[model samples]
Target: MMKKRTILRFFILATLLLCSSSAWAQGHSYLKTAAGKSLQAELEFHRDPHQTFAVRGDNLVLAGDLPVNVNYDFDYSVLEGQTLTVDGEQQHGGRNLVSIVTSPGEVRVESGTMTINKVTKEGEKAFLEGTYELTLEEGKTLSGEFKLHTQFRDYNLSSLGWVFMLASIAGVWLLAIFCYKKLLFDAE
Candidate 1:
């Protein structure tokens, strides 16, 4: 009776371990864009399990094993002479990788060829262009747009222009009430 109980316990423990390992191996990797978009991809492990992996864009998440010596690139597009800010963050062990952001002027890559150009103000208008590259296992590229903006011949403003105009009218009304109470009315 004692021998049988020992054997049963051993078998149950072995099965649990196998199942756990299998589940961990099947986990997926994820990438998120700056515009609140997300994409997931499966990771393929080679030799080392805790190697460095690279991810680009915002809120990048990785599961399972990491990759070795990974490189990631990010690019952006904006109207010429426009001041833009770029940023990124990594989840899990993703910080071990190196990330680079290249704008249109700093380094220009076309048709797999790299060229350095003096990014300058082109007349009174310019078109923005950039790219992002990730060195990792083969997978699909996910993309999405951030906030929308209209480009005019001279200036650009947020898409909420109408909202701003309405707010201005409300402000004027409030100011008028304040002025009337202060100059023409008595406190009760």
Candidate 2:
């Protein structure tokens, strides 16, 4: 009885831990100082699960595996300030990911920004939730949260995705065994 309960608890915990993994999102801060000097920075941001994620005081190297037509540049290299202040609290989160095409492809963005309003915390990790304002190079802008069943053509299979998939299978298997025992053998 106790053993079965322990196993059940383990399965539940594992599911939660695996499914709530974080996704990385970033942007840029283009600003002009009080003296009208221009400066720029590529911002790699992480909200919850870590309000203290470090933004280095040194030179930041910004690079990505983004599409060809899409590219990032800082108007002027070297962030003017040694530090940047970031503070925002969002109470809602959890991303609903779906398959855009099933076989996997790519998501292309021309321009604009992606703002994650709320970040979900699962165990020691975090999950994605927010809206993207994308402007393709041809003078078009798209604004919306990534909706359910909307798959990225080239979806990056993150570790969190694997963990969540495996954990779900394990949870289902465990639950079936547990139910079978409770019904047939009366293990309670």
Instruction: Using lDDT, give the best candidate's number.
Output: 1
- Give Cα distance to truth, residue 183, candidate 2, Å: 63
lDDT per model vs. reference: 0.34, 0.34
- Across 67-110, the per-residue lDDT of candidate 1 in tens digits comes to 12322111112222332222222233433322332321222111
Best candidate according to TM-score: 2
Model 1: per-residue Cα lDDT at residue 187: 61
Candidate 2: lDDT of 67?
A: 16
Worst 10 residues of 2 by lDDT: 68-77
Model 2 ranges with Cα > 4 A deviation: 1-108, 147-188
After superposition, candidate 1 runs with Cα above 4 Å error: 28-188
Question: How many clashes show up per model?
Answer: 0, 8
- For every candidate structure, what is the RMSD over all alpha carbons to the true structure, in angstroms? 21.1, 18.4
